[model samples]
Target: MDHAVVIGASMSGLLAAAALHRLFGRVTVLDRDTLPTVDAHRRGVAQSRHAHGLLAKGREVIDELLPGLSAELVAQGAIRGDLQRDARHIHGGHRLARGDSGLSGLLASRPLLEGQIRRRVSALPGVRVLADRIATGLLAQDGRVTGVRPADGEPIPADLVVDAGGRGSRTPFWLGELGYEPPREERVVIDVRYGTREFRRRPGDLDGDLVVIIAPTPEHPRGGVALALEDERWIVTMAGYGEGPGLALTEFADYAATLPVLDLHHLIRNAEPVGEPRSYRNPAGVRRCYERLSRFPEGLLVIGDAVCAFNPLYGQGMTVAALEAKVLLEAELRPQAFFRRIAKIVDAPWDITVGGDLKMPGVEGDPTPRMRMVNAYLERFHAAAAHDPELVLRFLRVTNLYDPPPSLMSPAALLKVLRGGAPRAVPVPA
Candidate 1:
């Protein structure tokens, strides 16, 4: 293979570049924004300031890509805590039971995590970063992608093209222009809006376990907060649904005051804000059915938000992206088949994200009966997770994208739902 060109140098793009570098001679990552040298937010990644947690699976993938990356993050003040024991989780006004699962995770800002990955990936041989470059269209010949064209320059040629351009990608348009029908799309509109504020933790604060309070709603909205990134820094976010108004600082404080779990609110009230409140509005969930396309071009692939963008509130994007990169590597390195195997590998994470998004009311998409069933089961699972510690761990593992969604319906989980009384049936997985 000559070289693989990856569009967008965000988390997904960086991971794709790493995978491609291992398979091909060279990899080039093109991004419209100039990434910062330090751990600072950028315009392209609007969700950077919001609460971001690296689930167990995502952490594992990052470690594989860059060994000791997790330890480095921890050394830089990222908190590594047991998901159940050290994290307070409230769902639908109920406190989720803490499980003894050795399932732990890194709590850091999106910028911090992305910056770490960028620094490591940039140091790798056979990889180059092209900042301040926008991908204008695909370079295709005989219906297969040849490379990418930037907005103000000549086309850059490559043997493979990976679209990690994110939710706003123009891949569909380019594909359609090439006479390849665009893939089927599923969309879910939650009308979710978010406002995030960072705070400097006071002395004696953050000594207790960190907390995540999930307030759900169709009209009034849902929100959450947690200690993230640097020590003594908290990233608090408030989200509203439907026609609900954006959250102001005063409004955020008022909403935090009403959480069923009062610790988050109390912490916020006493703490000082590190920056002004930033808000983001997401109108819908999008899943492009690339695998369903009758004739997907060879030497081309789509990953991350470019393939399937979900509600960030779920925190599934990074984990799903990491898993996709694993799939890409497996397919590329295998001897017998490549593109054929690639399609199947991307299916798991795609279904997980799209299926969950279809659950939200007012979401736009063809929600087949199977999708509805999956949503129903997850609702029961969430409700059961509140009281059952074993169930909570399983739920965490699944949500963290470590185990497949089918793990939720395993015999262990089923027995917990069947047998009442404290709801502990299986030992938590390490």
Candidate 2:
């Protein structure tokens, strides 16, 4: 293809642009937000102020797409530490054992991460980042997308158009207008609400750990997470589902204190607030089943949140987007092949997020027998992680998307769960 256009200059769009830059002669990325020059938040990103975890698998893909990117992040003040060893985690009402799992990633503000990638992608040969423009509609003719129509400008023509407009995308409507069936949607309403605030970090904050996580358990549905950010700062996010507590500036710390773990709340209570608290609601887990569509435009492919918006609590959005971008880099620009690849790319994240949401009372869908077994085993696995560092590493591997979820169900893992080894506050010595 000579030219490919990516709509929405979010992480997924940028990554897609980078992938296409090598194959196509020219690539263009458009976004509505006038992307800020500095490492600052933009109006387009709803969860920019929240805690974002670049899981192990995501870190690898980023480094693959932009070599030396991780180093740049760290040099620019991103904290680097073992995913488990330097972090505190509580799950299934027990603390996960701390130990080195050979997985590490940069902990930085969302803007910093996206800003760096945007700058790099913009500088790439034959790549253009156009801000202050929104894709008003798809340009289609003869069953193939011809380009995209911008809100205020003449249509930009292209051989292919990819939608990364996230969950708010209007691609389905555009498809309907083109006499094509939009992908059917699978939605599980979570009613998840979270508030985030940045805090000035000191050397001794959270006893110098990079992250303190009080994950939500069945008993205490409210949860909290704190991550060490660039420039001696921290971003703490507290979340709840259904009839949760108030998510406001005045109530942030109070909500944190109710978490299953105290370290997150304790740190935020003492740390100086650097910014006003901001809250965002992830109303549901939505997956547009594009793979199920019998017919789709040849020149159009949907990626990122435009295809599936995972539950934010899992931190799978960016990672899944990056993986899909990688797939786009290699796959032929055909609808069937593209949808198949992205479907496989999305399956893990969808299962993890959608399955978790369905477990909560009042949410939609009945858990499959296999899902019940998996969740039951995982609960035991979390309890075992308190005692067995190996089991903890295995759990982290699956959660980080480094390993398949089936790894957690291996006979060996099941035996480890049956054994239910010893317990310790910290599995590895500092």
Candidate 3:
């Protein structure tokens, strides 16, 4: 390919640029937001201000894409920890297993991680990060993309156009205008609101565990997550169905108090507040059924949130986007082959995010036999997790995209749940 245009210079766009640079002579990444010179969040990505998690699987993929990136992140203050061993979690009034499952996760602010990776990707031979630029629409001829139209400038010709504009992408509309059938979308209304704040990480927090997650069960629909980041700071995020208490520190305390786990409540009470609390709402989880489309435009591919957006609560968005980039890296970027591979890449995380949301009681989706069985099993599975570190490990493996969802339903796992019981309470932070 002579030229490739990637919309949205965020994580996914940057990754796509890195992948395309090898095949195309010139790769340009376009974004509307003024690119930050430092590690700071941008308006285009409002959720970056909230708590974000990088699963082990995603980190591994990044490492493969950019060698020594993980070491660089850790050197810059990313907290590296074994998923189950160093992190504490409680779900459905039960504690998860706490042993080394060989799964490792790196926790850092989204901006920091994105900044470091962007720098490396931009350093490549023919990659360009163009900021303050907008992709108004797609330029196509006879069902094949020919270029990109700018918001206030001339159109740029290209051999390929990758839509990485995320959930707010206009590709569907563009496809409609181009006389191609837009991919049908499947949605599950989660209506989740997130509140986040940064605090000073004192000597001992959450009894010295690097992270703590208080998951929201059907009975208790309020929950939050807190993690120790670099520079003696901690980031905490809480979720609710709708109408949060408020983002004020006091309001955050009130919301945390509602969760069955008191670790967050206690932390909210004692920590030195760094800034004003912020909250964002996610009305639903969306998956654009690109795989079902019989015909798609040539020289046009949609990746990342533009194709499927998962609930941020699972911290799977960036990870899924990275996986999609991996697919684009290996494939020839044909419509059917690419979409099918992308579907396979997202199926596990999408199912996990949507499946977990459906357990919230009000979210609507077809409760297929598999869904019902998984939900029913988790009730017992959570109780059993306290004693069986193996069960907790399995959950983490699936959640992190390290293993497929089917691994959780293995006969051995079911047997473990059958033999498990009530969990002990977590100790207060010393």
Give the clashing pairs for model 3: none
Candidate 2 Cα deviation (angstroms), residue 361:
3.3
Q: Model 3, stretches more than 4 Å misplaced?
A: 421-430
**Residues 256-298 of candidate 1: C-alpha lDDT, one tens digit per residue:** 7655566667777777888777888888777777766667677
Pairs clashing within candidate 2: 387-422
TM-score for each predicted model, relative to the true structure: 0.88, 0.95, 0.95
Query: What is the C-alpha lDDT profile of model 2 across 1-430, one tens digit per residue?
Result: 7999999999999998888888889999999999898889899997898899888898899888888899998899988889888998888778988888899867988999999999999999999999999889988888889999999989999998989999899999999999989888988888988888888989877777888877787677777788888888888888888754454545676877788877877887767788677878888889999989998988998899999999888888999999999987788879888988899878987898777777776676798876776667677778887988888898888888878888876878777876783342221111
Full-model lDDT for every candidate: 0.74, 0.84, 0.85
C-alpha lDDT of residue 355 in model 2: 71
CA lDDT, candidate 3, residue 130: 89
Q: lDDT: which is higher, 1 or 2?
A: 2
Clashes of 2: 1
Off by over 4 Å in 2: 243-250, 421-430
- What is the overall TM-score of model 1 with all chains considered together? 0.88
